[model samples]
Target: MKIILISLITLVSLVSCSNNSQVVSPKLDPLNQQFISEDELFRLVLHMDKLDYRSDEKIQLHSTLEYIGTEKKATIWHGMPYINYLITDGKDFSVGGVVSTILKSTTLEKGEVYTFPYIKTGAFSENDPNADFWREFFDEKDLYLPPGRYTLTVYCGFSLTEDVVNSKYNNKVEVEITVD
Candidate 1:
């Protein structure tokens, strides 16, 4: 009887230990997705909140630059808007803008990440030339585009050091999304 009790205790202890040793993985966010591009010195990741959106719903877009080089730290010099976007639907209709000529600089350590400013979407005025045509499909505030598939291309332009006149790097990544 003593032997039987000892065996039962050992089995229970083993089961409890096994349960405690199990590792639970983290759940991924469905709304947030990433498209990535990498080079010898940097890894650029483009983040989109969702792949599909309603005609009235707004879209979210952003990007991150990670220092993947073997150096202790790296400096990036660029203009006011270091990141730019070009969105198109494989047709004549496209959306983009120009950035200011003001210069700026940013530093990052090894394995460190730098997040750029968020990309704004759907900010059109009723006085736009195509406002009347787009009004049939989208609301005034959501006049970026109609419901369809689009390819969003992000450009990360910078130089390694303060000498912007010399070498420059332009990292580009693209992500596809659908607007219902």
Candidate 2:
């Protein structure tokens, strides 16, 4: 009985030591806006550089599209890449234009990461029919964000669909951002 007890104590100590040394990654936000398609072929991860921002400051964000399936997948997008943002209170800041060509597709292999250029968030507007404020050229006009909390949604895709102005993205990631 004495020998058995000593062995048990030694095993428990080893287990405890291993558990203490185990590495754990930080948990992502519940609303960080990660989505996997119904088929599980692709995963979309969307997040902003920071959770809070000063008024009129440029809010930077990134969208990463990863192919998770065993086989390579190709998807079509017609025009330049853009993110669709819809705030919680029913305000939106989005833009889309005509695609000169037809059927632009991007192919990705398993475990591949497709990186997009850092995109800056736009000001919220309900009456800007043109949605021109989302454009980078109009930086002078982008200083219109008010002090409040807003939901920053990012839909990853080419902005060249009939529902570009109205339809939300099938694969989207979102994050809650604040303006102070």
Candidate 3:
């Protein structure tokens, strides 16, 4: 009787363990940030709430633009200042996402800083133009990034003149993150 009871208990435990199946997202490694540019006309600072994340987790990124000039400067530009991210895996690069910022033309006072709200990486349009015609081809799933080491370089704004962007004032911040 003792032997039979032990066999039955072991079988029950095995069946119960096998029934416990749950879907869990992959875990990510810690994030790393690198600042490349030193031009002080406008400074871009990046902040992430947590360094590590899972594939299903939302990567919350906050960026701020501070006017570091001594006096007020006329910041003239075309459209609203937008964000572009270049993500790479040491081999190839992917246009991670783009935030289509819609802001009216404005000037920045000395020492004034503009902080943008946290932009969730999971819910961004992957460089989509957001036109009414091409809406059908884009979806949130298309932007799903797998677990890997990614270096994300963010360009804050485009230069007023194409030549200046190539030669001077290309404000940007680069950060490295691991998504597992």
- List clashing residue pairs in candidate 1: none
Q: Per-residue lDDT tens digits of candidate 3, residues 1-180? A: 554456446544553454222111133222354243445577766655554568777666555566676556745342233444556678733544442232223455667555554322312133435433233323343333458878766665544333433533467777778888
Model 1 lDDT tens row, 66-120:
7899898987887545667778899855664334444667677888666654433
Q: Give the TM-score of candidate 1.
A: 0.65
**Ranking of candidates on TM-score, top first:** 1, 3, 2
Q: Report the C-alpha lDDT of model 2 over 25-133, residue by residue, as the tens digit.
A: 2433334334333246667766555677788786555456666766666443433343344445336433222112323344456776665434233232334455453
Q: Is candidate 2 or candidate 3 better by lDDT?
A: 3
Clashes of 3: 1
Q: Using TM-score as the measure, which candidate wins? A: 1
Q: What are the RMSDs of all candidates, in order? A: 21.0, 21.8, 19.8
Q: Which model, 1 or 2, shows the larger lDDT?
A: 1
Residue 131 alpha-carbon offset, candidate 1, angstroms: 4.9
